[model samples]
Every structure is written in structure tokens, then in C-alpha cells.
Target: MAWAWLVSRAAALGSGASGLAGRVWKIGADDPRRAVHGLKVGLALALVSVFYYTRPLYDGVGGAAMWAVMTVVVVFEYTVGGCVYKGFNRATATVSAGAVALGVHWIASKSGDRFEPVIRSGSLFLLAAAATFSRFIPTVKARFDYGVTIFILTYSLVAVSGYRVDALLAMAQQRISTVAIGISICLAVCVLICPVWAGQELHRLTARNMDKLAGAVEACVEGYFAEEE
Candidate 1:
């Protein structure tokens, strides 16, 4: 069963890499190393969450905290950064997110939970600072927009949802650990297999790009010679 799970995950990773490689080439004029960095960032974030949440965080507090933090992160990414509400007053999204946070805080307060606003407040501050810095820092923008967004928005949502339900509803630590381990193994396998497929796709795209470059160079040369003539 373990071996099967490992193999399955590895296959998924390889498939994902193959899909990713094609998409990367299609996006036009992006740095290959940067794209790979984004991929690694996503994978690292996944591993971090698994390691952090799976062990538990002050019982229900940990889970609640995770949700609270997640809510903020999602709201910012989908709305502010994505500019989903661009024409419609950007503050609308920020205000809405604030309201949601307040409501959740109120609920937690009513439950007699100790107010631990620090985690969320600090997170928001950092998120804002990071967003602000992104304008000035190209790599930060690249890392967050490409690396973090890809994993958190795409991969982690489904993965975390399952982890949360299993951890809470069934209280199954062993089961969750097994799953995490399986995923890790699968990721490793994918790394090995993906390079072959991804390399071929990269080569094809690079050849195409080179062809365009050649045509542009020829055009420039012809124009220069014609001017001389």
C-alpha cells in the first residue's frame, strides 16, 4: 500500500511537471530559472504547512489560527494582487476582507477564546509590507506572484482541505502522516521523471524562440545592407 501510494504520487508529480513545462513555454519571455524557483517555492510551502499543521497548534487554536491566516492570504491574493476588483474600487475588496476578519474575531471572542490577534495582525502587516516591497523588489514580486501564488492558490487548497478534514473529523494523525509521507515520496519521484519530459518541451520552445531571433537578426542585417547599398 505504501509503495503504491508513493508511485501514484510520483506519477502525479511527473504529470504535473510535464504540464507545467508546457505552460511555462507558452507564457512568453519568462526566465526559466525563475519559473523553476516559483515551482520550488510552492513545493516548499506545501511541505511547511504539512509539517506545521499536521503536528497540531495548541489544539483547536492551531486549526483556527491556520484558517484565520489562510483567509487573509487568500483575500489578498485573489482580490488585491490579482486586481480582481480593479475597476470597481480596490478598497471594496480590502474592506470586505476586514469585515470578514472582524466577524471571525467576534465569533472567536464570543466563544471565550483568548484574543490572539497578534498572529493575524502580524501576518497582515507582513503581507502588506511584502506587497509594498514587491513594487520595489522584482524578485519578491516574482517569488510571491509566481512561487507562492501558484502553490497556495492551486496546489495547497485541495491538499490542505483534505488534511484539515481528516485531522479534525476523524482525528487521524497516523493517516495524515502517511499521506504526507506518500506525497513527499511522490514529489521526489516526479523530480526525477519530470526533467526528461520538461527538457524536451523546453528544447522545442527554445528552438522556436531561436528561430524568431534568427528571423529578426536577418531582417536587421538585410535592412542595414539595403541602407548601405
Candidate 2:
């Protein structure tokens, strides 16, 4: 149950990350190119979390192989999308770090029988930081923070699995079929319903923000002209 809560919270964070990335594109944020960067960063972070928890879904494969496959997917999808959205040459530091973390996951998984707490914790921190920072950070340098968040998250999962493999396995089984179906339905409904619901809320908030911004700008303009006169 606790793991389920953590997973749900992480998914929410990922969804918000996606929405924020979209907002960055819509608004032409600083270096409009960063919007594409943000999207890739968000996708990479989300994929890492997905890959870490879904290990049992695949059979008999070593952790390294599984990690490699997921890393490739994240890279290919992000690169393809980034090329289309921003341009072929428009890669960000975040994407590079994402690749590095994926490689690390593979290595850590293959290294030993017992999970490495340090590496796992580091990965979780990187992932969480990446997802949070990609959309919110205006500074380009902060993009690598996702690496730390994901490192920590992956490590935590390993710790749980190491201690209670049966429990973790059971959770995985329940989540795979049931959670997937439930979430698929919920997402479909959200797509159908949220636009109308969220649209109204967003419109109201946007209007309010515009009003405040307009008043502030007007006051600034008037003050400047008054000084000139």
C-alpha cells in the first residue's frame, strides 16, 4: 500500500512535469528551445521510474539487460521527439545525464547479489530532481539534478526488493494487470473530461493573472512617463 502511494505520487509528479513542459512550449519560455529540452527531460525521468519498478515483468533477464533496453527506449524516444520538436542538433545536458544514469542502473544491477544502497539512493534523487527541475528551472545548469533524484528512487526500490522480494513481487503482480487497466481507463476519462473541467479553471486563473499583470505594467508605464514629463 505504501509503495502504491509512492508510485501514484511519482506518476502525478510525472504528469505535472509533462503539463509544465507543454506550458513551457506554449508560452515560449526562456530559450524556447528549452521547451524541447524539458520534454525530453520529463520523459527520461518518467521512463527511469517505470523501468526500475517493472523489473519483474520481464523473466530471468539480468538487471543490466533490462536496464539497457529501457535506456535505449528513453534515448530513442527522447532523441526522436527532441529532433522533431526543437531540431536535430538541439540536445540538452539533461538528456546526456539521463543516458549516464541509465548506464549506471545497468551496471549497479549487474554488479552484485545485494543491492547497493548508495547508488540506488543516488539514482532516485537524480530522477526526482530531474522531473521537478526540468519544467521549473529557468537555469540550464540545473537540468542534471534529475540524475540525483532518480538515483535515490532506484536505490530505494532495490532496498525494498532485497528485504521483501515476495511482497515486492506480489505488489508488482497486482499493479501490472490491475493498475494498468485502472489507470488506462482513468486516463481515457481524464482526456475526455479534464479539458472541459480544467479549461474553465485555467481560463479563470489566466484571466486573473492577466488582469494583475496588466495593472502592474500600466502602473510602471505611467510612472515612467510621469518621470519623463
lDDT of 1: 0.43
Please give the range of 10 consecutive residues that has the lowest summed lDDT in model 2.
81-90
- What's model 2's overall lDDT? 0.46
TM-score of each: 0.26, 0.27
lDDT (tens digit, per residue) of candidate 2 on 65-153: 34433333333322232222221111233234334544555565676656555665666676656655664566533433434343344
Number of clashing pairs per prediction, in order? 1, 25
Candidate 1: TM-score?
Answer: 0.26
